[model samples]
Structures are given as structure tokens and as C-alpha cells.
Target: MIPIPRTLGLTPEQVDDLLTTADRAPSRHDNRPWRFHVTSRVIELYSVPERALPVADPDGREQRMACGAALFNLRLALHGHHVRPTVTFFPDRSRPGLLAVIRHGGTREPTPEQTRLLLAIPAQRFDRRPSGATAVPRNEQHGLRRAALDEGAWLHVVHDRPERALLRTLVLRAERLQTADPAFRAELATWSARSGGVPDCLPAGADGQESIEEEPLMALLTSHLTGTVAEIQVGQALQRVLLTATAAGLATTLLRQVVEVPHTREELRRLFSAARPPQAVLRIGWPGAGTPRHGGDVMTTATVP
Candidate 1:
């Protein structure tokens, strides 16, 4: 295990890099809702309440998941600095918005994997229409699964045919369900209209990509617990998985809506036999342009190493 330092301080360059890396996290509709507060003591993670998407993410589950991704990036940025960070999740029980507090720990050299992952941060993104026909190698899939375990989550690759069929049906149902709602479309369009995806906008033809029929290797990231703590870990697991995939020459996008609707989510959970509901579902494959919608199940799902 990496040791943690008691106190932490950051130079202007480190702080800038840290915040920059944190900002690169993928948010729903590209509405990045995470913020960072830096002190000589520790760095705190915050959620921008005003950035909440009501119609789609009514309870702020995805929003917090985005914040968790931001938090994971920040942790990696610190790791790049060669110092273990001691993190306090939901540091202030009274303040739910404060997601995590990270303090510098022991001095340790960054691992080769950590170094490579940090560099891949800028290249990592939600590739909507990535070419999924090409398969991901077994080694990389294991690494992706391990990344989730390294953090506090499980990566379940959807493999059963019945489950895959159910997932596709449920995903399509979610798209129709969301499309039928006028408010959902308006909100989605509003985000899409934003200039250059500024402030907020539908990313990579949002809603459109969700309908992609091609099923990729679907990896479901689930937390051991429920509520804030689990969601936060889910985000971290997500980034780790994404970065690992990116590093392995694989591309990804979130299969969000399937897990968004309550009934569909329960069905997805039952499909995987997951003890707790998953935080996010990932569609992974070779990188390509014209991204697809929250892509489908693990067509060639592999067990974690």
C-alpha cells in the first residue's frame, strides 16, 4: 500500500495541473459540476448545485458520479507529484456537497502505470461513435478490471446472451422513454446549442448516440455500498477504468440511461446478479470517430486479472 503524508502543499504549477486534470472529467451533457478548493493543508472537492440536470438526473446521482471522476483525477494528479494522498470522503457530514478532502501523505515514487495514466488524462474522453467492431485484448480488459478493484469497486463484464438481449431492449426503452418527454428533449437541446460545448451542451450528439445498436464489451462498475460514499467510489473506479482503457488503446463511452431509469436499472442489476446496483456502465472497444449513444453490453466481456 502507498503511504500517506500528514500535510500537503502545492506549487502554482502543480495546482494548475491538478485543477486542469480535474476539469477534464466527463460530465453528463458536458455540464461539469465539480469544483476544487486548494489549501496548504488539503484539497477539497465540491459540487456545483446550480449545474444540476433536473429532468434526466433528478436526484443528482450522475452529477455526483461526475464529481467522483473529478476527484479521482485529482488523486492521480497528486500521485503524479509522487506523494500519497490521505483522502477524507464527505469530510463534513453536515455538508453533503463537499465530496472529498485530500491531504498529502508519504513521499513515494510514481509507478510506471501511474505515470502513463496521468499522461493519458488529456487524451481520455467519452468517444461517442468509437469503432466497436475491433476487440479489446484480454490483458487490457484485465487491467481495466483491476483498476476498478484498486479503487473500491467491482467491474462486471456483461456476457450472458439473455442479459445482453435484455440490456439492449432496456436501453432502447430508456431512449424512447426519455424522447417522449418534452422537457427532456428541450433540456438536452439546450445543452447541445451551447457554443463549442461551453457552459453546457449535449456532447457528441447526445441522445442520438444512446440509440446505437452495436453492442461492445460492456463493463458494469458497481460499488459495495449505496448512497454518497458508493457513488464517489464509483466515479473513481470509472476514471481509473477509462484511463486504463485509454492507455490500452481502447475507447469508451458511458451506457448511462439503461442504469438511469429505476426499473431498467433493477433489471440490469438482476442481469449481472450484482449485490448492489451499478454506478455506471461502460462500452469499450477500438477508438473511432462518430461516437455511438450510451453503447451496449459486453459482447466479448473478459474476466479481470
Candidate 2:
């Protein structure tokens, strides 16, 4: 076993706590495709390609985004300890798995927003609900938008019915194509089944069609730039937005089908006249009374090898 990087200014227990929280970030099939390597003074983030789902995420975009989410959580955990994290993306092109490097920076108290998000890290979940789509307040919507902007991304809230109708068409088309693929279905099942008999399966009504009509709120995460670095930024922005929504007592789900299919994703970009490519679509709303804040098998594939 490798010894802890004591020069990084974190105790062994603190390192364990930090990594546990970081691994809690949501992923496509909860794949947790992130690995951390601690050097004398920095924490490095890596993407484990073996953990990726090639059929569902052929280009490895979602896997990279998921690692980005882990990066955000790791940053938040550092903030919780009052240590600022200096981040660098793709520091070594020769080592492609090296997604980011985080060095300990100046110590500062956590901001109110950061504290709220830190507390919300555990509450955030990839919720699945067929109904109970209450409207998100305008102020909260703006807050979510700002959360994304803070991380260098944009959130486009879909409020127009006609625009939503077009998105609905694209989503349906993508879902149909995916479901018809035997490999896709098998890949989806492999992950869903790994949830240890939880209700993580793709149910009939959860096809995201009803969401366009009754989900009350839907938003797309977009970035001005494209490629690996932009995807990492979008992932961090996605986690920040999700944590903000959770802190505000909102439930969120990913309308991933819309962006998973290549042609459908292109059509979505055209539909929105987006200057940047869309990274993810979020279905945000309020959960019903008695609804659990978190309910699913929280798996951690975060390895320190």
C-alpha cells in the first residue's frame, strides 16, 4: 500500500473523509470513473477507461463528465477544510488519464454558498419520479443558473412550449434509437442491475416524454467551448447546479437521452441555436411530501491505485 502524501497537509483520516465525499458525486450508472493519486503536494484526478460504458457512452464524454463531478466534490471537500485548491486540467498530455491536478492553496473560510453546497453533497441524488413535477421558483431558477455560471458554464431553462415541444421530439427519437439497440439495452441493464436490486431500473413512464409536458422545469447545461477540457468544466458546473438545487429542496434527474445520441444532440443544439454544445439536460422540480432525500445504493468505485 502507498503511504499518504503528508506534505499535502491532510491527515490520513482527513484524506479518507475527503475522498469518500468526492466519490458520492453522481454518474452515468453510478460508474464513479475517477481515481486519485496523491503526490507530495498535489492530488491528481484520473479517468479509468475500463469503468466506462462504451455502448451507452461511446465517446467517453459522460465518463469524463463524471470524473469532473468527482473533481468538484473533491474541491468542495478541500474548502470544507478551509484549504483552497489550485486546479490544473490535463497537466500531462502524455498521461491522458491525468484529468486534473489539485494543489493545496491559501486557507480561507468557506463562503455561505460553498458551505450550503458542501452540506448538500450527500443529499444530491439522481432522483427518478414519474410525477410530482412542481414549478421551480423564479429566484431558485436564477440561482441554479448562477451556480452553473460560477463554474464557467451556461444553463438554458426551457420555458417556451414550442421549444420544449421540439426538445421532446428529439428526446423521444433518441430514446427510441437507444432502446432498439441490443447492446445499449444490455449495457444499461448491466449497470442498473449492479445497483443491488434497487429501483434504479429504467421504468416505463420514466422515458422523459411526460417530463416535457408536466415536469414544470427543464434546463440544459451548455459550454461555450467543446472537447475534453470543456466537458470537465461542464461536469463541475453540473455538480454545482445539482448541489444548489438540492440545498433548495428540489429534486433533479438527468434527461441524458437527449444528449447521448449524436444526431439527436446535434438537432438539440440547432433547436436552441446554442453557441456552445449542450453537455447535459436536467429535469428539476420539487419532490412530494414523505419523499426521501436520498434513496439508492450509493456505490463508490473511487480507487487510489
Top candidate on TM-score is: 2
lDDT of 2 by residue, 1-305 (tens): 77665545888778888889999888876778889987768889999988998987898998888898999999999999988999999999999999999998888898988898898887655456543655788999999999999999999999999888887778778888988999998887787787653443223234556656677787999987889998988889998898888887777777678788899999999889998768888777777445654443221111111
lDDT of each: 0.72, 0.79
Give the range of the ten consecutive residues with the poorest summed lDDT in model 1. 296-305
In model 2, the worst 10-residue window by lDDT is 296-305
In model 1, the Cα lDDT at residue 188 comes to: 74
State each model's C-alpha RMSD to the native: 6.9, 3.9
Clashes of 1: 15
How much lDDT does candidate 1 score? 0.72
